[model samples]
Target: MSTDAAELTARLIRCPSVTPEEGGALILLSDVLTAGGFECHRVDRNGVPNLFARWGAKGAARTFGFNGHTDVVPPGDLGSWTHPPFSGFVADGMIWGRGATDMKSGVAAFTAAVLDFVAATPPDGAIILTITGDEEGPGRDGTRAILDWMDQNGERMDVCIVGEPTNPEVFGEMIKIGRRGSMSLNFVAHGVQGHVAYPHRARNPLHALVRLLDQLTGAPLDQGSEHFDPSGLQITTIDCGNPASNVIPETARAVVNIRFNDLHSPDSLFHDIRAKADLVQAETGVSIEITSNISGESFLTAPGPFVDMVAEVVAEQTNRRPVLSTSGGTSDARFIKNHCPVVEFGLVGRFMHQVDERVPVEEIHALKRVYGGMLEKFFS
Candidate 1:
């Protein structure tokens, strides 16, 4: 008997696997997958749960991998939901729950498709599933940990599909060939504190901080790359905590987040910002300090055989030629890109991370068909 994707999605949603919490979701999935002939491993790291399942022998001539997250963001304000966020209610031809679209459904669809595919055809190559629990949180211990373990254990994949919700408005409209990199920088300007009335006695770090921000955001990062939009930098927060009306603060802090294209890297951008801060420091005596965290670097899997294969299956299943896009925020794809050619495809993302998140029952079945078709083609 084949597993129903909709029922599996409903079962997953009811687990309350929010962010870092396993909430029994992985255990449930491991049980189902183990019975389906997959070798399952509990790849837990730093209290974050992850499941890695594989079908077929390791180091086969070819390997196909799928990556997804079981965890969903918190459902905010219980009163704002029409149905309880974790109810997994099946009504109105849709599954109602927090992870319905942002992607318990994606996981279910792919899992079911793979199970049915192996049972029916048993592909020539390997099938690997790397599902993580901390994708919505810090992300340091989720997919990254699984990949690290794979490296140590001599596991490899030729190509991978990330089941991130990729379509914006409708299913089959988009497939992500790549993603822009993301990094955040915290800036602190330090100066001597003094009374406001004696303006000459103490330098106000706020003034230098403003100039530093202006310098960073004054120009565009790029004129858009071939496969990406222009890079963006936004000042997320600025703070000078002095509450007194007549005092000059010793430090002014600001945070800037940059979503960059292939043309720039975290190191390059850091140097660029440092150059601007250097000018501000040279002009004013206030010293500037910058600390940065780079989430992932931009990557692209050029349109080729693997990409063309997935796109053809999507078009055949949905009759819409999916656009190869690199427009969304980062995902586990960022980590997988280093190991293999990766693309992201799943349900429409219009409801992801929003209140009353849901996915139509029909779309779930359609996605399973698309994934199943891909499996047939890839193995054939």
Candidate 2:
């Protein structure tokens, strides 16, 4: 049986499963895996589809899993691409589409590798795949849900490898080992409305809000951690409208997002921020309220046999030492981290979510070889 990597990636790219929509993308994969001597199961949760498949020894000792998502972020500014964003056209030796580099390509490469691995000899250990459709949007819809499902169904994994475009300068440059936590907060300061000319008659919320923001931004959340960098807090937005220069605004609002390391927790940051706001209010009459959105917590799996296996495979196949970096933003790996030791690596990511995003045909073939090597070594 032949495993055509390009054709599989093109089929997946054709479906514009942007965010919460599957666009029949998972079905395409289910068909392919089902025909490849693997048992496939589909679970639809909260209007999103998550697919799981397995092969080789039943109840094997080590259940190695390949985890990925089929969804793509919206192709921003549609007018910028050379071809339709969902067309998945092949031109200039690239399979052009939105999810080509961010993901999808990595999935196809590994699937092809698995097919090749099984053909040579039945998989040495149990191989499982968890493909979710809600990764690009509110993560609550996919990996998090599917992981719970896996646990309930008695599915366990010894190790998990996420295909999240870990390469930066070139293929095989980086393999992410951990990720920092992400949290967002919005605070609005309240004050009495009055004419600016009568300073004693009204409280200015802007004055207190500015002070609160100053305290939050003045210092680093922390010095660099042993294995991670210092935490960063950025003020994303601040709005205070007092259309009239002669009037004091009733409210002033600011939004801040913090990318924190293991040194800090959401609870600690919330208290620290509130303390700063309180101090500002003690000096000014403005009172404030805060709301938060938490995406994930920082997590790292100490370098061990599982991570070493992937690094060694890349070294042998690419003939270059791969850097195990925890550098980019977070991914579904955040959800997977709760259940199993997870890491991400894939194609060059210079084009993810960009107009005319694509991966070279040669690069696709090379990636397939690297994946094949990894699977072979893991099962050997």
Candidate 3:
């Protein structure tokens, strides 16, 4: 029996596979793929569930892969949803449930397309699927773990398509060619604690921290790059949790998040932030410490055969030329970029992560047709 994308999507949404929870979604997919003659593996790590499946011989000369997550973000304020978040209800010609658009539907579309494609054409190369349950959580052990295992086991894909919900408005309207990098910086300023009444004796750390933040946000990181907007720095938090107005606090902390393009690196940005801290220390005589965490660096898969082919298929299916874009927060695509050239395409995503999240029923089948077309063209 051939799989229908919409029905598979409904089954997936009913799992309530919230981040870091297997919720039985991967098991269902594994069963489906196994019956279709694919070698499937449960790549579980750190209590998180992931699936890697392949059809065709190992190390085939040409391989195509799809990467996605079955996990959905938590459904907040359950009473606020029109339909139960996990009901998988079909109403008004839409599939209403969590993960409906953010991407359980995307996974279903590609899986259905692959099942039909291999049975019909039996491509000359290989088809691989990597689905994870930890994408909406810490994400350290999802796709990254699968890639590590693939390296050890000698599995590789020449090109990959991340089934992230890429279209902002309508289906087939956009494809992500690259993504900006992300980093978080934390600052702590030390001061001498004393009574507020003694102005000359007490040093205020808040004053120094404010000066440091001003310097960091004083100007734009850079002018817009060829394929990206200018890097952005936003102060996310400032803490000086002293309740007593009479006493000055000994430490003040602040945090800033930076979204950057190819023009900068984590080290380069860290160096600049430390320089500002040093200047503040010299002027205020207040000791300051800076620390940072780099999530993922910016990456781009330049328009080429793989990208052109995906775009061509999208345009033909929807009758609208898709725009190559790089606007969005980071995704698993960041990790996949290290393995091979990668791009992101899927259904319209206006409802992702929102209460009553949904995808139009027609769009689900339309997406399957587009994915099926790409598979046919890639193998021919």
lDDT string for model 1 (200-253, tens) is: 999989999999898888899999989999999999999999899899999999
Give the C-alpha miss distance for residue 23 in model 1, angstroms: 0.9
lDDT of each: 0.93, 0.85, 0.93
As a whole number from 0 to 100, the lDDT of residue 25 in candidate 1 is: 89
Clashing pairs in 2: none
In candidate 3, how many clashes are counted? Answer: 0
Among all windows of ten consecutive residues in candidate 2, which has the lowest summed lDDT?
Answer: 55-64
- True-structure lDDT of candidate 2: 0.85
lDDT of 2 by residue, 1-380 (tens): 76988788889999889988889889999998888888888877878889988886546887778888899999988898899888889998889998888788988988887887778777658888889998888888688777888788878777788988888878777788898889999999999888889978999898888888888888888887876888999989888876788888999998988988889888998988888878888889789999888898888877888789888888887887888776778888888888889888788899998889998877777778887776777777
| TM-score per model over all chains | 0.98, 0.96, 0.98
Instruction: Please give the RMSD to the true structure for each candidate, in Å.
Output: 0.9, 1.5, 1.0
- The regions of model 3 sitting more than 4 angstroms off are none
Per-residue alpha-carbon lDDT of candidate 3 for residues 1-380, written as tens digits (9 for 90 to 100): 56799999999999989988889899999999999989999999999899999999999999999999999999999999999999999999999999999899999999999999999889999999999998898889999999998998999999899889999988889999999999999999999888989857978899899999998899999997898989999999999899998998889999999999999999999988898889899988788998898888999999999999999999999998999999889899999999999999999889999999999989999999999988988999
Weakest ten-residue segment in model 1 by summed lDDT: 212-221
TM-score of 1: 0.98
